[model samples]
Target: MTSTPPSPDAISYFGIEVPFMQHIGLRPLLLDSDRCHTLLAMRPDIVNSRGDIHGGTLMSAFDFTLSGAARAHDPERLGVITVDMTTHFYEPARTDLTVIGRCTRRGRSLAFCEGEIVDTAGTVVAVARAVFKLVVRQPA
Candidate 1:
């Protein structure tokens, strides 16, 4: 069986159509060679005990965003898997968040990317750097 490549405009193009992303209201707005952007609507249930967006949530968003950026910038359209990620929380986020991700460098089998989470007011809430491994699929 063969699966068609997702349309560039489709959310599936960035692998953002998963159940968790849907449940968290993650919306991919733009994805191109230079960068990727996503929106996460604030949900009360997704907040921490202190009523702010949880660190885990931010990390998850960063991972997704960075992965998307790497894929977008790859000419081969190869599959990507996150190898490692380091996240830093600068401030607690209390509002909806916009995640911006960019590809820093790409090699034959790996890619490095960075992402930032910002609130509605444009304050940086968190930042992340991640490495993804690119995989090639052999034709059947």
Candidate 2:
């Protein structure tokens, strides 16, 4: 399944507004056959008390990005429920960041993906792996 990178105006899986993407400072960096990745320019407002990008924010981004990847593989109308997720925080992200999620394996009913969050300088900040239960809509 060959996929092309979506334009900036392309709609995201979360149904996020294009302006909101800019507001959140996330740009769709790359979209490939089995992956959709985004880069986020971290803002102080999204940082934690320790001055690091909050873990929850990273997790949210990870989930969103992976779901995008899954959808790319199967555009059939469906919702993804994250059955399980595990994240490892390697280092703190203080500035601009990049989050990449790639579908490692896809099944008829489930998809597995892994993602990483890195600082602008290319240091790993966090890593996450998730399994999503893909629910396909049936004809009414």
Candidate 3:
């Protein structure tokens, strides 16, 4: 996918409102509206017993970032709910991590996305493929 760099303020999505994402230090680095890039710092509170970033933490970040990708088609007017996700852990993320997600295909109802988590040195730690159902955003 091609993208221009995004400013910190450029990211504005429901994922940022997620309490768990916030608790885990998942920060949106970019979301040029079609692709989502996120950062998570490795900290004691967010690690597994082995002292590496936990799989659940990685999965949560992917879910939020991938959902952002699905919603990017029409963000303000669109919403998404996860239909399914398949994730694979490749290694223990021992340092800060970045996740990037992009929509591979989008149909009228379902959008498919793929994402990966990489370390500061660009080693991939995990990957996830997901499907999300598009919905209209209801007025608050």
Candidate 4:
């Protein structure tokens, strides 16, 4: 039987809890075997001096979202550490946004992932691709 999908707030978006991510206000929206979707509500804290969303905030969201996708296969049993990421900015983000991440390819010890950020009006804000090294999560 197909289980009920989880509500946004019910999910542990990062797989592993990360205080910094929490502080950044990234919230889990959806997670699947090969993809993850997350939300980032615009806040004063993430805004740059010029009043646009800071690029660093976008990058961090990409890192966390892509990592989540890379480990989505078995989040509770696996973890991923980012090896590298490249991001391109297409527009200045001025509002809340959604990040969609996909694991493009998976190997025994590494995974390739990509992510896109779109603002509330559906404008493309940024896109990123990354590599992550997979590791077994040790019992805490």
The CA lDDT of each predicted structure is 0.82, 0.77, 0.86, 0.90
Lowest-sum lDDT 10-residue window in model 1: 8-17
Question: How well is each residue in 54-120 modelled by candidate 4, as lDDT tens digits?
Answer: 9999999999999999999988899888999999999998999999999999999999999899999
Model 3, poorest ten-residue lDDT window?
Answer: 7-16
User: Which stretches of model 4 miss by more than 4 angstroms?
Assistant: 1-11
How close is every model to the real structure, measured as TM-score?
Answer: 0.84, 0.77, 0.87, 0.90
Tens digit of per-residue lDDT, candidate 3, span 96-125: 999999999999999999999999999999
| Residue 138 lDDT, candidate 1, scale 0-100 | 46
Clashing pairs in 4: none
Ranking 3 against 4 by lDDT, winner: 4
**In candidate 3, which residue ranges exceed 4 Å CA deviation?**
1-16
Clashing pairs in 1: none
- Error (Å) of candidate 4 at residue 125 is 0.6
Name the runs in model 1 displaced over 4 angstroms. Answer: 1-16, 74-76, 137-140
Q: Total clashing residue pairs per candidate? A: 0, 0, 0, 0
Q: In order, what is each prediction's RMSD in angstroms? A: 3.8, 6.6, 7.4, 6.4
